[model samples]
Target: MSDFLVVGGGVIGMMTTLQLADAGHSVTLLERGRCGREASWAGGGIVSPLYPWRHSAPVSRLATWSEGFYPELALRLFEETGVDPEYRQKGLLYLRVDDEAQAERWAREVGKPLERVSADFLYAKEPQAAPGFDDALWMPTLGSIRNPRLGQALRCRLEAMPRVTLREGSEVTGFRQSAARVTGVETADGIVEGDHTIVCGGAWAAELLERVWMALPVRPVKGQMILFEAPPGLVNRVVLMDGRYVIPRADGRVLAGSTLEETGFDKTTDAEAKASLRASAIGIVPALAECEVEHHWAGLRPGSPDGVPFIGAVPGLEGLHVNAGHYRNGLVLAPASTHLLVDALLGREPILDPVPYRLEGRVTSRR
Candidate 1:
């Protein structure tokens, strides 16, 4: 089996390395900081797209496939690592769905279970919700994961694998090329060589690949979030309105976020954003207004045009590949994205068509 070097220890990279190692290939995963402490750790793990109908076909395909695969993956991770990701299908309620017609059409086309529910039903289901809307769009099958716990489970599982080498704090500065193929990567400590190199360095993917003269169009879109440590039943389900959401955890914590600021890797949490998110959270669930804001943080999502991730071999470069640019849906899309990449790498029949994700002339401009 080919020895592989997987860069970026976020969800995508770790999952890729896990799959490769499970297939009997030796794999080394390198992370600049602690694994999963970046975007992967800081995401609201909605198992579906924020607005599924708003995305393109490629995003839909990956998300759909991943939605089916996540339950098993979460279960397996918890069983192996004893860390429950808290995967729960608490359903998602859209308080203000403007284009219900288009949403219904998309749901019908995609076979996703969606319902146009009445205000009475919505209130009865979630009495804490702020009232006034006549009706709402309900996605009953939608779910979420506690992303930080998921990362912990992945880290634990990876450490237990003999074929996997988990290297934290190893930043890859550049790639060592032999003719047209990438032989290895140049890290902070020393050169780490491998037969093939896969760059999964989330927001840093573009810069890392640029070292090898590969211009990948991946940028960091900063998203800020605020957590409210409220009573357990204050907010029951994931409530979304005006592009922001309030997600209730099994414990008492509720998460409200996020602003899509194209601020170029700045993760500093601002007071304005915190106020806006707090208001939004209170607007969705009135009881949260009194809850203490326990934590506020930001994450840099690997943004791409149309939120479609690149997941294939780099053009004009052999033995070098990327599976980055997942934007806001990294947690939701991780299972299928990694599976597709691994299938292509191992020369097996892919789970889906790999053409849309291929990196050729796909990225016309930086996102």
Candidate 2:
């Protein structure tokens, strides 16, 4: 069995480790902090892209494939770990507050079924929605999952696997590299040897590679989101207005997010950002104005130059791989990415082309 070291214990890292371990590979996961507490836990948990048509073909393919795997994964995790990930198919309503013609054009190009409804129909479907909002594109297949619950479930499941070893609060400082391969990682404690090392560090990926005089073009795009507690059934569907979105959970909480900021590694929630999100949410759903704000937080998404995530092996580093720079679609793309990583590592044919996700453009010259 191949010995594998997975750096970063976010959803992508954890999912990859699980896939590899299930394939009979000895897997060890190292997390700098609590597993899955970073972007994976802090996300809005929307299981689909904001605009599926706007994304590139590769991203759309990966998302579609990954979304198909979530239901099975959720069920398995709940059965094995007894923690529900709350995977729901509550459909998404993307309101076209402005730019009706643009929305129509996109709908035609996307080939996805989008029904144009009047203001009355929208209110009849969701009475809590604001009065002024009218037309929208309804996508019945779009859905969401509870991110924190998924993380917890994955951790619990991993703990039950004897082949999987989780090292929490262990920071990997650098790597031990030869002429063409990374043999092991240099951590705060000491060198940890492994056959393969996959860096899934999310926003912190670039910093980890910098210790070896290598740099990834990835940057942390800070997103601030707010949560409000409403009565159950207040909002039944996920709604998106312009660039903002409001996701309702099975519980009484409605998560309204998020402002994408280019700030580096600063996860501090801005009061103004929260206020802006609250205003936007209220504008879409007036009933939310009466809801109590429950929580507000920020996360650093690993933003790439292009919108697509970086996957597959890092060039010139034979045993090193990267599965980060997923931006806001990390959770949505986790399943397919895990599959691709495993297939590539095992010398099997990948479902998608691995060229676009290669680290050529992102990584600087390797030592």
Candidate 3:
């Protein structure tokens, strides 16, 4: 069996490790901190893109393929690890409170079945929604997942694999390269050699690539989210308003997020951002104003120049690969990303063209 080393412990890293191990490859996963505690845990867990038609064709295809796998993957992970990821098809309601023309354009461009609903229909559907909000486009295929629980489930299930070695709190300082191929990684403890290495470092990918005088154009975009404890059935479906979203769990927790800021590696939450999110969320659903805020935190998303993830072999490094820069859709695209990476490593046909996300000629130019 081939030996593989994955640097990073977020959802993308964990999922890639799981896929590699299941394919009978000996896998070693190194995490600088606790696994899945970074962007993966901090995400809003929306499975579909904010605007699917606006994204590249490859990105949309990967998301569609990954969404199809969540049903079976969630069930299997829950059964094996005894932790429910809470994958739900509660649908999403994109309210068109202001931009009617933009909403209509999106509906036509996406070609998805969408129904225009009036204010009365919205009130009937979600009694807690605010009064002023009127028209909305309903897309029933969108879904969400409990991100923290998903990470926990993945960690548990991956730990059970005989061929996988998980190293938590292990920081990779650099790599050992011979000509164009990476021989191994140099960690805080010592050098651990592997046949191949995949950098799934999330927001910290560029730091690792810098060791090889190469960089990926991945930047950290900060987002702040708040959690509220409410009664069950408070809100039945995921609701989207402009750029914000309110997601309700099966229990009694409602998650409201988030503000996208171009802050570099800063995970601090801003008071103004929080206040704005609270105001905007309450505007969408007035009941959120009464709910107690249980938790408030922030995380950085790995963003790229073209809003698409870089997934391919790193140039000048034959045995090294990258699957980072997924921005906000890491969890939704994890399965398909892992599948594509595995196939590329094995010289198999990829589900989608690797051209748009390729890393060959642009490695030196990437920031």
Pick by lDDT: which candidate is best? 1
Candidate with maximal TM-score? 1
In the range 1-367, model 3's lDDT, one tens digit per residue, is 2399999999999999998888788999999999999999998888888766567777877888898788898999999999999999867888764655564676667565566777787877788877776567777778889999999999999899999999999999999889778988999899888999999999899889988888678889999998888899888888888778899898969889998999798898877888888887887788888888888899999988876889988876788989999988898899898889988987789877778788876568343
Where is model 3 poorest over a 10-residue stretch in terms of lDDT? 96-105
Model 3 bad stretches (over 4 Å): 97-111, 365-367
Name every residue pair that clashes in candidate 3. Answer: none
For candidate 2, report its TM-score: 0.95
By summed lDDT, the worst window of 10 consecutive residues in model 1 runs over 358-367
lDDT of 2 by residue, 192-229 (tens): 88999999999998888786666787889999999999
lDDT of 1 by residue, 328-359 (tens): 99998999999999999999999989998998
Q: Which ten residues in a row have the lowest lDDT in candidate 2?
A: 97-106
